[model samples]
Every structure is written in C-alpha cells, then in structure tokens.
Target: MKILFLGDVVGRAGRDAIVARLPGLRRDLAADLVVLNAENASHGFGLAPDMARAFLEAGADVLTLGNHAWDRKEIVPYIEGEPRLIRPMNYPPGTPGRGATVVDLPGGRRALVLQVMARLFMEPLDDPFRAAQAELARHTLGASGSVQAIVVDIHGEATSEKQGFAHSFDGRVSLVAGTHTHVPTADHQVLEGGTAFISDAGMCGDYDSVIGMQKGGASIRFWRKVPSERLAPAEGEATICGVLVQTDDATGLATAIAPVRVGGRLSQALPS
Candidate 1:
C-alpha cells in the first residue's frame, strides 16, 4: 500500500493548494491513503467542521491534530463522533475524541492511524512511548487479530524525542511520521526493522511567512511581547510538504520512503 502523509495545513492558502494539487499528486504517486495534519487548517488554529469536511473531500483519508486540536470550542462534539479524525492519543483519559482508529482501504486492507504528543518542549501528557507500544502491540502485523498496517503520527517539538519514539516502534509499526514543527526534515528513510520514519513532514502553507504566519505580525509579537494581533497567513506562493511511503502487503513493512515538496520556495517531488 502507498501512503502520503502531509504536514500542518496553515490557512486558506494551504487548503487551496492542497485541493488544487492533490488530485494530480494522488494520480502521480498512486497513493492508496492520504493522512494530513490539520491542526492549523482553520486560520492557523483549530479545525472547524466545515474545513475538516473540505480537507476530507480533497483526498484526505484521515485528519490528525496536534496541540491546537481544541482551539475551536465548537469542534468538541464533531471530534467525538468523527472516526476519521484523530487527536493526540497520549492526552488525558477523559479527552473528548479518540486517538486511534482503523480505516479500511479499497483493497480490503485496514490501516491503523495513531497520534501521540511528546513532553519535551510540549505540553506534558501520558508517556507517549508507552502509549505507542501498547497501541502497536494491539495492531501488530501478522498477529492473529492484527490490522493490515499501523501508521503513527508523532506530534512533538524535540527531534530527539521523535527519533526515539520511531526507533522504539521500528518493527512493530509500518510508518512513523512527525509533525508540529512546520519545517520539513531532510531525513526520510525506511528503518532497519521496516518502518518508514521522518523527523518532521513540514508545513503546507506560505513559505515566505514565519512558520506559516504573517512575518510582520510575528515579528512584532516576538520583539514587543505585547499581544500583537493574531498572525494571519502570508500572501504568496504556497507549498505542500509531506512524505510518501510504500509498504509491502505480506509483512506490512515499508519498502520505500521519500519526501514530497511542491510549489512555493522549495518545490520538489520524490522520484517515481
């Protein structure tokens, strides 16, 4: 199965770029599933139900959230009922929505999507490593009652923590991708144990802005410390940053891993 994981979608520009380019991308890559980080999709905050639906309609199979998952209060109910949407799994026990779910693909294959947040440089949460291990164990490939493949989205700040988590579940899961940094990492490869891993997938928004936020506004907030108004999306060429992973059916292990970039300042795509 071929899977495409996109990083944080910042705002209107990001959403438009995804909708405009995803169909061609899906065709070119022959992607079987597409997972997108939509924590910042709605005006760089939380995702509204309408925006979430738009993302789903634009070829996203599942949507993942990060620290900004609850920015929009109205989404609480939708999050609880939407199985295709996932928030950080390591959140406290009584969180509104689930952290993992099984999505059945076209070929009768089931893919497990799990999201976890790290503690370093991020809000403290349940032990992400332990949480991942338990989840992977439940969906181990080839196990009597296992799912076809397991994909993990590690939303965190520290690169070390993301790397450690990926290594910990090397063979147990099919793919482990990172998010929240909004900056794509150069490392993209299949682990020794067959899992596809990347430290960060990058952001899908304006490249000229400061991490997808308007530079002018962000600058003021940084230097003045006064509540300069909320940052808006930059108006310029947009880009889509993500990774493409191809997994083997028999063992549910990654066969290929490559970074994908299109439009904006950094425009490049993986070799077919």
Candidate 2:
C-alpha cells in the first residue's frame, strides 16, 4: 500500500497549494491513500467545514486536526457530521468527531487512521498512550486482522514525545508522523519494527516566516514579550511538506518511507 501524509495547512496559501497540487501529487506519487493535517487551514487557526470539504474534494482521503482543532467555533458542530475529518482522540471523552476512522481501500483492504496529542508543552489532554492502545485494541493490524494499514498522527510540541509515541506503536502500525511544530525534521526513516517515522513533516505553507506566521508580527512578539496584532499565515508561495510510505501488502508494515517537500522556499525532496 502507498500512503501520502501531508503536514498542517496554514491559510490561503496552504489551501490554494493543496487545491492546486494534490490531484497531481496523487497521480505522480501513485498514492493509494492520502491523509492531511488541516488544523491550521483557516487563517492559521482551526479548520472549517468548507475547508474540510475542499480538502476532501481536492484528493485528501482523510483530514486530521491538532491543538488548534477548535479554534473555529463552527467546527465543533461540523465535525460530528464529517467522518472523513477527525480531531485529536485524546480530547475529553465527549469531544466532537472521532479520534480514529477505518478507511476501506481498494481490493477490500482497509486502513485505520488515528491521531493523538501530547501533553508536554501543550494543552493537557487524555493520555495519548492509552488512547492509542484503545484504538489498536479495537483494530488489530497485520494479516490476522481486517486492517491492512495504520497511520497515526502525533500532534504536539516536543519531538521526544512524538518520537516516543511513534516507537510505542512501532510494529503495530504502518507509519507515524509528527505535526504541530510546522517545521520538518531531518529524521525520516523506517524503524526496525517496519513503522515509518518522521519527527515532523513541516507545514503546507510558506517557510519564509516564523512557523507559517507572517514575519513582521511574529518578529515583534518574539523580540518583545508583548502582544502584537493577531498572527496570520504567510501568504507567499507555499511548499507542500509531507512524507510517503510504502507498506508491505501482507504484514502492513512499512517497507520504505521518504520525505516529500516541494515548491516555495525549501529545496524539493521526494523518495527516489
């Protein structure tokens, strides 16, 4: 199975980039399933129902949210009706939308898509470890189970927490990628357990600013410990950042994983 997981989408630039490049990306990468983090798509805050529909229409099979999942008020109700869009599972038990979803693939195969948020340097949430365990308990992987592939998105502030979460479920899932930092890391590799792991996949917006925010305002707040105008996503050219994973058909384990960075300020990167 071939899976393409995109990072967070910032504002208009990120949305436009996804709308413009996703179809071509799906074709060029030959991705069987496409998952994207659309947490920051709405003016660099939370995602909207319209934005979710747009991403799904563009080619994203599933959309994941992070800390900013509720930044938009309307999303609270919109999420319940949209099965393809999911928020962090670690949110309180009554949180809107599901934390994990079973996506049926071609040839009668299926994949489980799950997301969890870490507590370190982040808003307190349910224990990610427990949340992941519960999902795995419900949907076992490998040939013995109905699921053929599993993708987990760890949204948090610390790399250590993200890496740890990925390792905790290393052999059980197909891939585990980090988000929320809006900065791609250099560590993209398959673990001994065959799970593909990346510290961060970066954001789907311009890299010229501070973590996708406009430079001017971000600079003022950073240099002076004071409030500036509301932070907005940079509107410059966007570079779609993410990773592609190739999994074994039988075991549903990752056989290969590589970073996908294209357009904008960063040098292009893709699996060979």
For each candidate, give its TM-score against the true structure. 0.96, 0.98
Tell me, by lDDT, which candidate is best: 2
Q: What is the lDDT of residue 143 in candidate 2?
A: 67
Task: Compute the lDDT of residue 3 as modeled in candidate 1.
Answer: 90
Which digits, one per residue and each the tens of the lDDT, describe model 1 over residues 195-240?
9999999999998999999999988887896787878888677889
User: How high is the CA lDDT of each candidate model?
Assistant: 0.89, 0.93
Error of 1 at 51 (Å): 0.7
Residue pairs in candidate 1 whose N, alpha carbon or C atoms collide under 3 angstroms: none
Q: Model 2, 70-124: lDDT tens per residue?
A: 8999998889888889888989978888999889888888899999999999998
The per-residue C-alpha lDDT of model 2 at residue 37 equals 99
Off by over 4 Å in 1: 142-145
